[model samples]
Target chain A: MAPAVLIEKLQKRYGKVEAVKDVSFQVEPGEIFGLLGPNGAGKTTTIRCICTLATPDAGKIEVSSINAIANPKAARQKLGYVAQEVALDKVLTGRELLQLQAALYHIPGKFAKERIDKMISSLGLQEYADQKTGTYSGGIRKRLDLAAGLLHKPDVLVLDEPTVGLDIESRVVMWDILRQLRDAGTTVLLTSHYLEEVDALASSVAIIDKGVVIAAGTPSELKDRVGGDRITLRIREFCPLEEAEKAKDMLKSFPFVQEAIINVAQGNSLNLVVTPQSDALITIQQALQAAGLPTFGIAQSRPSLDDVYLAATGRTLMDAELAAAGSRDPKAERKQNMK
Target chain B: MSSTVTPSKPNVSLKPEAMQVSPAPGFFGELVQETLALTRRLFIQLQRRPSTLIAGVIQPLIWLVLFGALFQNAPKGLFGDTVNYGQFLAAGVIVFTAFSGALNAGLPVMFDREFGFLNRLLVAPLASRYSIVFASAIFIITLSAIQTSAIIAASAFLGAGWPDPLGLGLISLILLLLVLGVTALSLGLAFALPGHIELIAVIFVTNLPLLFASTALAPLSFMPRWLQMIATLNPLSYAIEPIRYLYLNSDWALNSVVMQAPWGAVTLGGALLVLLVLDVVAFFIIQPLLRRTFA
Candidate 1:
């Protein structure tokens, strides 16, 4: 069977800015695939192209073997898109908005009514159904938006930054709902910059940056490819640079230690990458004790998705996000997204 | 409470053979549905928060009563031969109300665009995006009709004479044509302009000037040569004159003369034709612009 969604070599540009370039990924049936990137990394553009909201300058995007660009209407029938922003008409009640959504998707009248009720109940929106959306809280509004997207039960559901700006409880609720959706045989594709969000929910992920797909694999697979356990060691609570360097040099002599760098930003602590071994932390402690260095703190863990991003891009996601934020022109970006 | 029974296997309803769900072909029917749905949304909004509609109706009624009184003391024949100044001013108020209402048709759509609500409609499987344009047109025209009726009723209550039966029908027809044309132009700008602020700025600058320049406030014959030329060329003048003539002459026919343009005399039939042509031209001009943003 063909994948639920197939995008190959997608390219999109907003004037001189290449929003998406040379991006390709496939989402398997009954799986949650994530596009992980910083804010300006073109994940939204890629999803927009797949949903046929914006025309791509070049690329092949398909939904259930139907070409999205050539037969957008058919592809649209097979795909449900929940945009980043919840664009509900404030004047419309939650139930009324769902009814409108049902009509737009051409659901059969009887089935539409049943499905709408089911969605409203399942999403815990029954009490708010008759109230205008303007009166809804952010979480309630997002739940309604999700209900509207799922009214047609398309084969694949695409979400952009699904949990952004939500309170912790709402985010947890959204995650549980997404898991239920995946278990019920719906394919899910989502874009998110939150590391923990993708790490926890996505079965597989593609890390995109500067409009290009830099890495793609299962979460564990990508993490394993980076191949190291991280250890942060501080000789003193706030060590001098020279003492941190001495500790780093001594730690580098260990056979399991692959690399060591002093993190001056954290008061001259040493961050070390060690080959995964049971006694690596013990070995580092021994070395520090021999040097008459008092161990202020020490911790060790397997590499995380952030490490995967850091290894691939040579910069942390946070750094890249700040850089991208400073360079973005809000006015131009708003214009590009308007249509 | 009803968790008593567990079956041998999870109950899975036999799926009906997947019904072929597809959008209708061609843009017309889909456009109709979307337009109707959008227009229905506007009416629902009006039904719930009717402050704008209330203001629209009340403002004109006040203008008809108060402004008419301000001119009540003027010479009787100074405005026209047999028509009172109040009667002459009634047609201008009616035309002005419709024009102003139609001019504002873009405001809601522009707000939708600015607030990101438009993206919701665009992402749907719309057969043609032109449904957005059609919806705005329908909503604006319906609103113009409501405002026009209120103004007409208020003017009549203020002792301004009512038009004959045929004249009333003609008045509605003219209002429809004029509203259609102006609504098209306004909706076009809603798509072309960057934001609601820019669109509202344009509307503000153009609104009162167009009203003053047209025959809505004063007849072309009463204006200076330059002002008369400008008023004659204004499309609002074309709408106002025919309705004004119907109010002033009970026996008026299609061939009855409404105004003398700089170059020629415009009859009632000629003015109606001009409005029809203007509607066609306005839609034609906006076709490419709408296609660019919508398609």
Candidate 2:
């Protein structure tokens, strides 16, 4: 059987902005696939093309072996999309909104009622189901949007930033529910900028930057490809630049320490990538003490998804997010998203 | 954590290949189902928040009463023999109310577009996206009917005599034709325009101008020659003249002269035909636009 979802060489442009340029990925059945990237990295644009909400200027998109461009209705039947913005009508009760979703998907009347009831119960929305959605909390609204997307039990469920604004408790609940859906044989695809969210939930991830897929693999695999243990050492609460440089120079003499750089933004703390070894942390602490630079705090761990992103893009995801934020035009972005 | 638990139906896999494929339903059945589903949503919105409906009905009633009182003592027999200005204004108000209501039909659709709710609908497995347009037309036409009734009742209360049974039938026909045509145009604008702001701007500029240019407030003869020609050409006049003629004469025939245009005299039957043609033309005119977006 073909993969549940396949996108090859996907290209989309909004005027001069090449929102998605040459994106490609395949989602295996019953796996949680993640599109991980910073804001303005074309994650949402890629999701839009897959869900048939926006036509791609080029490339092929297929859902369950059906060409999205040629047979969009068929692809729509197989795919369910939950957008980043919860587009619920303020006047509609949660139940009414689900009913509308059921009808739009052409669910049989008998099955629709049962499915909507199951969704309301599963999402723990029974209490709020009768109230207008305008009165719902953010968490409850996202849950309702999720229930609406799942009402049809689509073959591939596509979500764009599903837990962007949820509280920790709700975010946990959403992750559990997504895992449950995957176990039940639904191919789940989601896009998010939260590295930990993807690290915890996604079985396989694609890290995209500026509309290109920089790295794609299982979280552990990608992290292992970076091939180092990260060590963060702060010489002082707010170390002087000279003190940070002294620590960096002292730490670099160790054969296990592959690279060390002072992160000026974090009070000149040293961020080190050391060759994996059992006692790398203790040796680094001893080296700092010998240099007469006190270690305020130090921690060591295997490379994380964030490290993989940093290794690939030469900047942390947070830094990329800040950079993208300053350059983004809210009006132009809203216009791009409007249609 | 009982990962070893086996299903009773071991062969019943959840994969797509295990699913049975059934033949899709016939075209008309699917169309009707989808259209009804969409129309039901609009009705539910109208029911839950009856403000728009209430305001729609009340506004036209106020126009009929206040406007009728404005010209209550106009020169007798000036409008026509035995036809008071109030009586003459009733048909115009009814047509104008429906026309205006139909003109604003695109607002909800435009809002849907702006809020990304339309994207939700577009991504669904709809049988035909035209059902979206059809649902809007049904809702707007129903709304115009309610507003038209309010105008009819208000006119009757203001001593504007009621149309005979046959006249009422003719009036309903004309209103439906005009509503269908205008609703199509409004929905077309909803899809053709970029956003709600642009759509509202167009409606704002077009509404009062179309009302003034038509025979809604005054007779064609009262206007300058150029304005009279424009009024005759306005589709609103085609709807208004027939109903106005019906109210004035109980024994009116289909071919009775209703409007004296600059070009020639248009009979009641000819006015009805124009509305019918307008409906057909408007539907075809928006076909390509709807297809480009919906297809």
Candidate 3:
């Protein structure tokens, strides 16, 4: 009856770094909820707090009506966490690792064996199940890690960056498994920086930036929030700032073109928001031709999650990723995650 | 597609599950199950990669053989009326081997922590987190037993006579007590320290110093006043002296005076009591560290 997971006003600080600050979201039962953010945006920290791996400085995290903070043991029993890093012991075989996981979640020996076998087969790890995980490829390791996380079939499954470093095939597999888990009545929560991963898989998304939730809605609802068709137009492949400004001003003059901004990080490209008009692209091309400006490239489509993010944060997700990457302290982050 | 049939619904409520899993076992039952499983994993690792075990036994045998021979030509009364140094050195070697092996018990756990393997264990619905520590203790104590056996076997072959059955059993008891204490500290260090490199540094600085200061290689009389004070205070000394006394005299009693520390003579019973106290103190000291980590 309570939401599968309710994290209200969550705050976590690691020494001087406020890893997660003032985050709130509710995940409905049997739904796949995505916490979408860039690196160092506190998604993992938030997951850690929810899964009871790290204590939140302040928050209410209830997993299936259990208070995760006040009663971590009971909450942990109801939650399965697949950490961002695949934390399998290299020496352990896939089956052995799952067995260990089953026991930790207190799956009785008889039931554990049955579940382990079924999970290994369902996860497509039968061939590698008995082999030491050290010999596994990245994809295989991720599969095993997923199986281990799901062995207990917790009511709420929490995953942190489930496919950050995985290959395309593996990523697709991971997504499929997540959907299957949801269809089978498991409430799934995942954090990721990949827009498409979230857009394609997550039923609803919470966009977080700098440890704050800037937006929360279904993927299409978020896409609809910006309320216009997106037009990304590049002049001369790399337009000059003045030319980009001129193009922005020209585009803004049209009644249909409600908003225009120059994307400085993308070679001074012009990003526009226009009311849905069938010939918006053609009209833009004609305007460029009449102005004697060469149109290097142009495309138009419905606003995506990136546009939603940009509208709310004043920058694209890629831009935020680059900025966050530059200022990140890997050493300190490692220490925080290790804790 | 079967998967794409369900579109993203912004306001749709998720229906509860039609079928739920059967409930888990009671707390203590689950705790025992998990602990045994974790301990079994450690043993399986040891079984597959027997290098640590092989090296553990071999290193002490080397010390017993080579180090015992190093002083084979010492004066007859040099090691206190023992016909040979091997006889006197057996207890020290056995206790020191157990101590050294126990000191490194935290390495596996430290590696687990460093590589994020410990995070896997931590996130589980473990009944008690201390089961992690308990599993490590069980593994390390088993290893100490194996290594102790190897050392004792090698010494007996080198003309260091074996103690009577009761003496042999007492030797095991003393080593078990010592191992429990040291293993607790090592596991505490595993959690308290940042990484394996620092843990190894602590172990490197600690291993030999504790041995040297504990009358492992030489008797208490061989040390200067300050060194004697340190060696007397060392817990390893308590274990080593009791076992050494048992080996020397077939007629040993629990109250037999084994060594005369700077303070006074400590009987065999007194030595065992000291080791027991050391075990208690070591565990007491590490409780807070474990709490901070497992919290």
Candidate 4:
């Protein structure tokens, strides 16, 4: 069978902003595929193109071998999209909202009733199903949005930042539900900026930056490709720049330490990439003591998805997020999403 | 865990044909279902709030009682022969109320667009996106019908005599045509304008000017040449003249002259034709705007 969704050479521009430039990815059936990126990195734009909400300047989008660009109506039938923002009419009850969704998808009346009941129950929204959605908490609202997206049982379920604003408990619950969705033969695709969220839930991921796919692989595979044990050391809670530089210089002399740098954004903490399985944390602590510098905090672990992002993009995701946030135009972005 | 076990149909496949084993409804059936579903939501909103409806009904009555009294002491033969100002103003109130209500049709749609709720409707597998337009038109026209009835009842109670059954029918037909065209333009504005603030601005600038330019508060003869020319050119005038003619004469015919315009006398049949042409022109003007988004 063809990939559940295939987007090749996707390119979209809003006036001068090239939101998605040469993005390509294929999501296999029944897998939780994550598109990892920072804000303004074109993840939502890519999702919009896939869900047929926005037309691309250039690309081939296919759902189950059906060309989404050429035959959008047919492709839309196979795709279910849960946008980043949970949009529900405040006046409409949760059940009424789902009923509207079901009718829009053209599900038969009797079948729609059965499916709506099942969705409400599965999402644990039974108690609140008949209440106005305006009374729902943020978590409950997101759950209702998820239920609406899944009401039709589309072949591929696409979500954009599914857990952006949820608390820790709600985020974990959403993760579990998404996993269950994948196991039940639904092809799940989600975009997220959270490293652990993608690491814990997504089976495979594509890391995008500034509209380009910088890296794509399983989380572990990308981490393995980054290939090192990471050691983060801080001599003080707010380490001085000189102290961090001293630690970085002392750590880089060790044969096992492959690279070292001071992260200026995080209190001038020293980050060291050491050879795998090396007892780098203890050795670094000892060396710091011998050098008369305090070891306020230190950690050693295998490379994570963040390491993959940093290795490919030369900056942490948080730093990229801050940079993107500073330059974003909220008014322009709202205009882009309006249609 | 038991709930998680749901939705696991083993027949999941990537091929399109496999998913189509159960036949879906035809296009028109699906369109009707979706349109009704949307229309139902609007009615539910109206039911719960009822504020807009209450205000819509009350405002027209205020216009009838207060504005009618404003000119109550006018000399006879001011508006027309055998017609009092109260009787003459009922048609204007009916037409103006419906026209303003239809003009505000874009507000809800504009809110929907701004709040991203429209994106939900757009992403669905709709048989045709024009159903969105159809649903809005249906709701606005329905509200117009209710408000029109309220105005008619209030006018008859206030000594503005009721039209005959056929005249009532023609009044409704005129209101329906006017609402359809105005609703189309309002919905088109909802899609074309960037935000609700801009849509409201357009509506504010439009509402009163059109009312004044038409024969809503005065006859064509009461205006100067420039104003009379504009009144004759206004579509609201076309709708108002025929309904006003119906209220004045119990035995009204289509070909009877309803108003003497600056240029010439316009018959009731000619007025209906003008409204129809206005409807056609309004739809044509908004076709490109709707196509950009809906297509």
Docking class of 4: acceptable
Per-residue error (Å), model 1, residue A78: 1.9
DockQ for model 2 equals 0.35
| Candidate 1: regions farther than 4 A off | A234-242, A264-268, B1-32
DockQ of each: 0.33, 0.35, 0.40, 0.43
Best-performing candidate as measured by lDDT: 4
Ranking by TM-score: 4, 2, 3, 1
How close is each model in CA RMSD to the real structure?
4.1, 4.4, 4.1, 3.4
Fnat for each model: 0.31, 0.45, 0.49, 0.50
CA lDDT, candidate 3, residue A219 = 91
lDDT of 2 by residue, B1-295 (tens): 1113221111112334332223556667667777887788899889989998888778778877788788888899877654677887888889888988999898899888788888889889888898899999999989888878887888888888788998898899999999999999999988888888899899889888988899888987789999998999999999988888888789999889998899999999899899999999999998887876787
User: What lDDT would each prediction earn against the true structure?
Assistant: 0.84, 0.86, 0.87, 0.89
lDDT of 3 by residue, B101-180 (tens): 99999999988887888888888878889999999999999989988998898899999888899989989999999999
TM-score attained by model 2 = 0.95
Weakest lDDT window of 10 consecutive positions for candidate 1 chain A = A103-112
lDDT by residue for model 1 (B106-190), tens: 8898888877788777767776777777777888788888989988988888877788988999999999999998888888888
Mark the 10 consecutive residues where model 4 chain B has the least summed lDDT.
B7-16
lDDT of 2 by residue, A164-239 (tens): 8877766777787788778778899999999999999999999999999999999999999999899988889999
Top TM-score hit: 4
What is the C-alpha lDDT profile of model 4 across B1-295, one tens digit per residue? 1233332222222223232334767999999999999999999999988898889889989999999999989998898853689988999999988998999998898888888999999999899998988999999999989998999999999988888998899999999989988998999899999999999999999988999899989988789999999999989999998999898888888889998897999999999888888889889999999888877
